[model samples]
Structure formats: C-alpha cells, structure tokens
Target: MKTLQQSRAIIATAILGVIVSTYALYVEMAAESKPGYKALCDISEYASCSRVLTSEYSKGFGIIPKESALEVPNCIYGTLFYCFMIFLATFDHIGVNRLQLLLSLVSCASSVYLAYLLAFVLHDICLVCISTYFINGLLLWLVYNKNKQLVEKKK
Candidate 1:
C-alpha cells in the first residue's frame, strides 16, 4: 500500500512536469513569433531567443539547447528537467534510491537557478515559467519527503 502511494505520487509528479514543460515550450515558441525574438538559426543580437539559447549558459559542454532546438522556448528546459525528476522519482519508487537522490538534487539546484534567471536576468516572468517552477518545487519536496520516509523505515 505504501509502495502504491509512492508510485502514484511519482506518476502524478511526472504528469505535472510534462504539462508544465509543454506549456513552457508553447510560450517559448510563441515568443519567437514576437519581433524581438529570433529563431535558433538566426544569430543576431537584438533581444533574440537565439542569442539566449546559443549562449554559454544554455547547456553544458557545447551541447545544443534541446529546448530551443525543439523550438518551444528556452524556458522549456526547466520543464524537461522536471520531467526527468519524475522519471527519477519513479525509479526510486521502484527501489533505485541513488538515482532518485542524485536527480532530485539536480532538480533542486536547477529550479533555484531557473528562478534566479527569470527573476533577475530576464527581469520578466512568464506564467508558464512560474508555473513550472512551482511544480518543480513541489516535486522536489515530495522526493525529499519520500527519501526521508525510506530512511526512517530502514531505522
């Protein structure tokens, strides 16, 4: 029964993550249609989405921005990362605690960084981005709680 509950929690988190990601992606794509934002192929510097996506902060080790390439919006990366959180939580629910712990930590850190970017750097907060951040926070909390419960059970 406890396992079932945990499984449901993980699944619910995943679904929420996917929903937030899709919405964020939609916003990113729509932003492209605006005059200031540019498609990834365009590299000009007048408030271009392409500029942000291609920037050093976009991804690690020269990997292209998956979210931008998908043409949704750069913010969709948070959505996708949250989706990964769900996957990790599910794996943890199925008895893989280490993966879950590592991923959740990553999610927590990413969420903080994203919030910082939205609030400080962008100086503009989109509804979808805010929603995704909230969801990520909730999922992180849940993952932490589950891990705590597991530790308690062991003791």
Candidate 2:
C-alpha cells in the first residue's frame, strides 16, 4: 500500500520534471534559432530564463568543453533522468529502489551545484530551472521514503 503510493508520487514528480525540462529545452532551442527570443519565463533582466538557458552552463553543466563530443544540453540530461526515474519507480524490488535512491542523491547534489551557479555565477533566476530543482528534490524525498518502506517490510 505504501509502496504503491510512493511509486505514484515518484512518477508524478518525474512527469512534472519532464514537463519543465522539455519547456527549458524548447526555450533554449528557440533562443538559438530566433534572434531576440524571449521565453514566457523571462520576467525581467535578472529573472530571465532565456539568459540562464543560453549561458555557458546550459550545455554540459559548464564542465565539458564546447568542442567536446559529450557537450549536450543540460535540459536533455534532465529529460532523460526524469524519464528513467518514472520507469524505475514502476519496479517495486529492493534493487530498483536502491538504484532510484542513488540516482536521486546524485540528482540532488547536481541541483545544489546548479542552484549555486544560478544564484551566484549567473545571478539570474530561471523559473524552469527552479521548477526542475524542486521536482528533483521531491523525487529524492519520495525515493528515500520508498527505500525506507522496503527495508521496514523486510524486517
């Protein structure tokens, strides 16, 4: 019963993450294609989604060089991560739950780093970015609860 509820929560959170990541990807692409493109999330100069999405950190989390082959857009990574979370949550096995917890931990750490960059480095507010971070944090909480439930069940 609890497991089912947790699975549903994780799936729902991942779905929301997918939506926000997809929107960010669209904004990134549109900004690249169109000159002076402004996203709906672009509220002002400091709170501009377009500005953050097109910055140096937008691709490969500013880690990979632009000339590198692995330098894909960060939104693509987020989309794939959320999709995988949804799929993993479908399995109720202990191994699957452990994997989910591990992935969520990594995601949360990445979110913290990205949040710092957004606040300090970029000095810009991205609604889409913030939404995805919230979604990721929710997923981490859900996955952690699910893992706890599984351990309690085994005891």
Q: Show model 1 residue runs off by greater than 4 Å.
A: 34-76, 92-95
RMSD of each: 6.7, 0.9
Clash totals for all candidate models: 2, 0
Cα-lDDT of candidate 1: 0.57
Candidate 2 residue pairs in clash (backbone atoms < 3 Å): none
Model 1, position 152, has a per-residue lDDT of: 71
Query: Could you give me the TM-score of model 1 versus the true structure?
Result: 0.63
Cα lDDT of model 1 by residue, 13-59, tens digit: 76887876665454455554664654433334433434444344434
lDDT of each: 0.57, 0.94
**Residue 87, candidate 1: C-alpha displacement in angstroms:** 3.6
Identify the leading candidate in terms of TM-score: 2
Worst 10-residue lDDT window, candidate 1: 54-63
Q: Which ten residues in a row have the lowest lDDT in candidate 2?
A: 129-138
